[model samples]
Target: MTTAAMRVPVTRGYRFEWVKLVSQWRIRLVVLACWVAPALFVAGVSQQATLPVDTLFGRWMHATAWAGPLVLLGFAGQWALPLLTSLVAGDVFAAEDRLGTWRHLLVAVRSPRRIFVAKALASLTVILLMVTGLFVSSTAGGLLAVGDRPLVGLDGHLLATGDAAGRVALAWLCALAPTLALAGIGLLGSVALGRSPMGLLLPAVFALAIELAQMLPLPVAVRLALPGYNWNGLFTSPMQLRSVLISVVAGLIWALTATALAYLIFVRRDFTNLNHDGSARRAVLAGALPLIALGAATVVVLAVAGLGAGSGIGQDKVQRSLATAFAHLYRVQTGQLNRPDVTEAQLGASAACTRGGGQTDPEGPGNDWRCVVSWRLPDTTAVGSAIYQLDITPDGRFVADGDGPKEVNGYFLVRTPAGDAPNPLWQFDGTVELLPKG
Candidate 1:
C-alpha cells in the first residue's frame, strides 16, 4: 500500500470493529447485565428505608425520586464503576487475540495505529453505554418506587424534587470522567496481557487494591490521588467543585499515563512469532513488572508523606474553623439564620483541642483530636460547652463526629446551648474548612 493510501482515515476500521463488537452475544449479555443489575438493586433498595447510610444519599430512600441513583453512584465508586468500565475495555484488545484474529485484523487495517484507535473507541463506546444504561435504569427504578419528593440535602437543607433531580443528573455526568479513565486503564491491561481473563481481572484487582491502599494509614494526599476519594463530593450540599475537579484531574492523569504506556508497549512489541492459535504471544519480562510496581508505590508513599508533613491546622486555625462551623451549624439546627448574641467577636467561642489518644499519629485510625468548645449562646444565660471529636485531613480540613453521649445520634458536631429550650446550639454533620491565616 502507498504511504498516502495507508494513511487513509480509520473510519472503516472503526466500523468493522464496532460491527464485530455488536454482533457478539457476550457483548449483548454484558450490556444486559449492566442494565438489569442496577435496576434490580434500586428496586430492592427503594422499598426499604435501611439503605447503606455510610454513603451519601442513603439516609432517605422513600423521601425522594433521585435517592436511589445517588446512593448507587456512591456504591459504584467503590467497585461497580471500575468493574463495569473494565468489563468492556478489558475485552477490546484481548477479544481479538482470544479469537485468534489479531494478525488478520492488523493486516486488513491500513496501519496498526488505526486498529488500535478503533479498538479503543469501541471500548469507550461500550463504557458509555453501560454508564447510560445504569443511570437510566437506576433513575427509573427510583421514580417508580417513590414519587417525586423534596430531598434533604447533606447540609440539612431541603431541596425541591426538580432541583434534586438536576443535581443528581449533573453528578452522573461528572462520574463519566472517572469511568472513562478506568476504561483506559483496562485497555492498558488488555493490551499488556493478551489473555481475555487477565484483561478482565487485573484492572478490577488494581482498582480494589488502590481503594484498600487509600484506607490504609497512608497520608491523606495519597488517598486523594486515588479514584473514589472525592466521589462523595457529588453529593455534598453545594456540590464540592474543588473536590470534583481534583478527582477528574486525577482520573485523567491515570487514564492518559496508562494509555501512553500501553501504546508504547504495543508499538515496540514483536508480532512475528505467533503461536499455532494465531495469537501473537509476547514474552513476559521476569521481575521487571514487580520492580516497577514497587518503585511506583514507594514514590507515591514518599510523595504523600512529603505533602502531609506539617500540613495540619494549628490551634488558632482550628479555633476559627470551629467557631465558623459552629455558628453555621447552630443556624441550621435552630432554623434561625442569625442571632445577634452569637456573634463571633462578642460570644467568644473558644475550642481547646489536643492531638493524641484517638489521634496518636497523623495518619492513624479513629478521630485523632478532641476539642472542648465553650461559648455563650444568644440568650447568654450562662457559658455552654460541648465536646467535638474531629478527624483532620492532611490538608487541614476537619470533620467533627458528634456520635458521643453529649450529642444526637449519627455523626455530627454538637454544642450545648446556654438555655434549656434548644438543647444543642449547633449540630453540624459535615466537613469544616480551616482556611490559612493571612
Candidate 2:
C-alpha cells in the first residue's frame, strides 16, 4: 500500500529550475537590459563630439566603430561584470529561502545536491546569455552606427578592420573568465546570507573590496591573481599568452574555492527554520551601510592609487617602453603633419630614464619620471634628444609630456588642419607590460 517513490531524473530538476528562472519578469528584464545597454552606449557615443580620452580605447571613439565595444569592455571590467554576476548568482539560492519555497523544492527533489546543481546550471545559463547578448549587440550596433573603420591599437598603430574585430571578440571571451570567478563569490553570498537582497549586496561589497586591493601597491604576481587583472591582456597588441594563462588559472582557483565552500554549506545548512521573521528587512538595513562605506572606501583608494600604484615602476622597463612607445606615437605625429612617410624603424629611439630626480634608482611609479629620449628621424644621422615627464602606473600605463612649450616639441593641443586636437607627441598615452615577454 506504500506509494512508489517518485522517480525523477536530475536533469528534470534543471528543466524545472530553468523554467522558473525564465518565467520571472525580472530575469527577462535583466537579459534585455544587458543587450540594450551596450547598443545605447554605442548610439550615444556616435553622437558625441568629445572623446572619453582616459578610458581604454576612448580617445579613438570617433575614429573607429570598434572603439564602442572595447570602451564598454573596459567599463564592464571596472564594475558591470560583477554587478551582472551578482544580480543572478546572488539571488538564485537565496530567493528560495526568501519565498520560503526551499522545503517544497527539497520535498519534490529528495536531494539537496540535485537542486543545487539544477539552480547553478540555470544561473550560469542565464549569465552566458546575458554576456553574449551584450557583446553581440554592442558589436552590431557599433558597426551600424559608427562604421567599420580600422582601430587605433594600444601601441598607437592602426589595426585593420578584420584584425580589430577578431581582437574585440576575443577580449569579450577572455572577460568571461573573471566573470565566472565573480559568479562563485555571488553564489556563496546567496547561500550564506539566505536573504536575496543581502546576497546581492554581499557580492557588490566583495567586488568593491577587490577593486580597492588592486589599487594597493601589490606585487605583480599578487595582482595577477585577482580576477580583475584578467582583462589587461585584452588590450595588448598581439595578446599575451601569459595573461590568458593567468586568467584561466586564477579564475579557476577562485571559482572552485568559493563554489566548494558554498556547496558544502548549502548541502548541510538547516532549512528547517523557514522562519524569516523580519530577517529580510534586517538584512537589507544591515547591508546598506556596508555598501555605502565600501563605495566611499573605493573612491578614497582611487584617489590614492591615482597618485601611483605604490612606486612599482621599473627603470629599465620604463626606459625601453617609453622609447618604443614614443617612436610609435612619433610616426602618428609625422603622418598628421603631412610629412614624408615615417616608419617606426626609422625612429631608432633610446631613452635614459631616471626616477625622482635621481633621488631614487628609476625603480618606482611616480609623476617625476624623467627620460632623455634620443631618436634619429629618417634621413638624419643626428640623434635628437627630447625630455619627457612621465606619470606611470604600476601596471605600466603612462601619460607622458614632452619637455618645454609647444614650439619645442612639447605636447599641447597641436594645431592640425582639421582642428586643435590632442598632440600625438605632447601628452600622449602608452603602457608597459608587467608580464614577462616571450
Candidate 3:
C-alpha cells in the first residue's frame, strides 16, 4: 500500500468519528443543562428579600461556582458528565461491537489505534466546548441578576470590584481540574464496558460513592485521593495558586493512569462475547473501590479540621457592639439610672445614669444634679466608655443636654400621666416622659 493511500483511510476515519460524536444530541443536552442551571439559581437568589444587597453577588457566585467544572465532570465523573461523554466515548468501541461492525471497521481502516485516538479526541472536544459554554453563560447570568457590585467576603470585609470578578473567574477554572480527571475515568469505563451504559453508569456511581465516602472520618493522605476535594483549591479566595497547582498535578496523574488502564483493557479484551452479563458488575466494583476510599479519607480530614477550629465566632458579636454603642449614647443623654425596681416598660424607654453633683440653683424649689451612666451593650463592646451631659428642668417637666450651645442640642418631650394636665416642667426633647409612681 502506498503511504498516500494509507493516510487517506486514517484521515477518513477521524472525520467520520468526529462528525458522529458532535452530531449526537446527548452532548448537546449536557451543554444546555450547564448554562440553564446556574442562570436559574442566580435568578432565584436575586428575588430573595433577606439576602443583603452587598452579599447578593457573593452568594450567587458561590452557587454557580461548581456549575462549569461539574458540567465537565458529569462527563468524567461517571454520572452526568460521564454519561454525556460516554454517549459518544462509551459507544465509541461498544457501538461497533453491538452492531457487529468492530471487525469490519478494523479491517476497513486497518488500525484500531487510529480509531481510538479519533474517538478520544472527539470526546475531549465536546467536554471542553460544554465547559466553556457553561462558564460564559453562568457568569453572564449571575452578573446580570446581581449587578456588577463589589462582593462581601466571608470575613465581612468587602472585596474590591475587579478583584472579586477575577476571583470568581479563578474559581470556575479551578473547578475544571476534577473534570479533566473524570474524563480519563470515563474513557477507561468506555473501553471496559464495550457498551455505552456500563461506561456511563459506572463513572456516575463512582462519583456519588466517592462523595459519600468523603463524608466519613479519615486521614488527610487518604482524603487527598478523592477528586472532589482536590477541586476545593479553586474556591479558596486570595488565590491559593500553590494548592491549585498541586491539584492540577494530582488530576493529571489520575487522568494518565486511567487512560493507560483503558488502553490495556481495550487492547487485550475479547469483544466476541460483548454481551457478557457479569462485566457490568465487575466494572462497578472496579470504579467504586478507589473512589470510595479516597472520598472517606477526605471527609475525615475535613471533619477533624472543622471540629478543632471550634464553633465560629458569629455575626452576633457585630450586632452586639452596635447595640452597646447606641445604649451608651442614650445613657449619657439621660440621668435616669437603670434600677431593678424600674418597670420593664420604663427601663426600655428610659436611659439610666448615676447622679453627679453640678451647678445648683438656690433661688428655685428644684435642685440641679449632674449624673453619669455606664452600660455596655453587645454592639458597643468595642467602645470601652461613653458619656453624655444631662440637665433636669426647674419644674421637673423636662431634661435637656447639648455638647455646645445649640450645636448638638436634643430634648425628650415628657409625656404626662393619664388624667394629668400637660406640664411644661416635664417637657423635654423626644425621649423623656414622667409617669406617676406606680
Candidate 4:
C-alpha cells in the first residue's frame, strides 16, 4: 500500500466517521423524530384543557412556556432518550460488524483507536444534536400553544418567567451528562455483542432496569446509585443543587467506566471476534447471561438490604406513641420547640387515640387510627384541641391530619429531635395556614 494512503490523519478518521454517520438513514430518522415527537406531544397535550398532574411540570405547562421544555424532558427521559441515543450510539461498531466492514476499516484506518474515537464522537454528536432539536422544538411549540406566564413551583409558589426559563435551560444542560451515560451504555453493548440489534436493545433495557430498581422501596443511598437517579432534581422545587451535582458526577463516572471498559475489550479482542461464527462472538454472547444473572443478584441484595428492619407493634403502644407524637407535633407547629410548656412538663398535653368500635390493632397495616389532641395555642390562655387521623407506617413514620391547628394546617409529623440535632427539627411534608374564605 502507498505511504500516502496508509497515513490516516486524526481529523481524517473523525471526518470519515461523520460522513458515514450522515450517509446512513438512522441519523436522519433520529433528527426528524426528535423534532416531530415534541411537536406532537405538545399538540396532543394542548388539546386537553386539563394539565398532566402525573408528570413534573404538567400543571405548569398549561400556563408557562418554560414548563414545555421541562415536561418534554420528563417524558423523554423515561424511554425516548434511551432509544434515541441507542439508535445512533448502538450502531457505531455493531453495524459495521454486522455488515462485515470492520476488516476493511482496519485496513483503511491507521489504528483501531482512531476508529473507536471517531465512532464515539459521531455518537456523542448525534445525541447532542437530537436533544437540542427536541428542546428547541418543544420550547417553541409550548410558547405558541401555551402562554408565557410565570410557572407554579413544586411548592405551589409562583416563579418569575425569566427565572423559570433560565432554570429550564440550565436543566437541559445538566441533562446532557445523563445522555452521555446512556450513549456509553449503548457503545459498550455494541462493541461487546458486535450485533446491531443487541446494541439498540441492551441500552434501553439497561435504562428500564435501573429505573425500575430506583422505584423500589430501597434505601436513599441505594436508590442514588442507580442511573439517572437525581436527574429529576432540576424540576424539584428550589432546584435541588445537591442532587443535580450528584447526578452530574455519577453520570460522568458511569460514562467513563463503560466507555473505558468497552475500549479495553475492543482493543484486546481479535478482529475475528466481530464474525458471527467466531469463537469470540460465541464466548461473549454466552458470557452475557452470567453478567445478567449477576446484575439480578445485585438487585436482590439491594432490595433486601434496603428493606431494613421493622417490628410489629400492639395497640396500646400505638396509642401512646400517637399521643406523644401529637404533643410534639403541636409544639412544633406552635413554634415552641424549646419551651417548657409541653416538653419540660411545666404544662400538660393530652390525647385520646382510637380505631373505632374499640378495635384491638389500631396500628395494624391498612388501619386508620384517630386521635383527639389538646394543647394550649401559642401565647394564648385557652387550650386548643382537634381530632386527627393518623396513618402509621410499618417503620413507625406517621402522618397526622385533622381540622388542624387554629393558625396553620399541617400534613405530617416527625419524631422530635435530640439536643443539638443536625437536621431541621420539623419535617412536615407541607403546611398551609388557615385562611377565612369570603
True-structure RMSD for candidate 1? 6.0
Give stretches of model 2 more than 4 Å off.
1-7, 276-312, 402-422
The most accurate candidate by lDDT is 2
- Reference-based TM-score, model 3: 0.57
CA deviation > 4 Å runs, candidate 1? 1-8, 147-163, 234-240, 276-377, 380-429, 432-438
TM-score of candidate 2 to 2 decimals: 0.85
> Looking at candidate 4, what is the lDDT of residue 44?
64
TM-score-superior candidate, 1 or 4: 1
Ranking by TM-score: 2, 1, 4, 3
Clashing pairs in 1: 359-368, 402-412
Which candidate has the top score in TM-score? 2
Q: What is the lDDT of candidate 2?
A: 0.73
Q: lDDT per residue, candidate 1, 30-52, as tens digits?
A: 78977888777887887874656
Query: Residue 370's C-alpha lDDT in candidate 2?
Result: 85
- Candidate 2 backbone overlaps, count: 4
Q: How accurate is candidate 4 locally (lDDT)?
A: 0.62
Ranking by lDDT: 2, 1, 4, 3
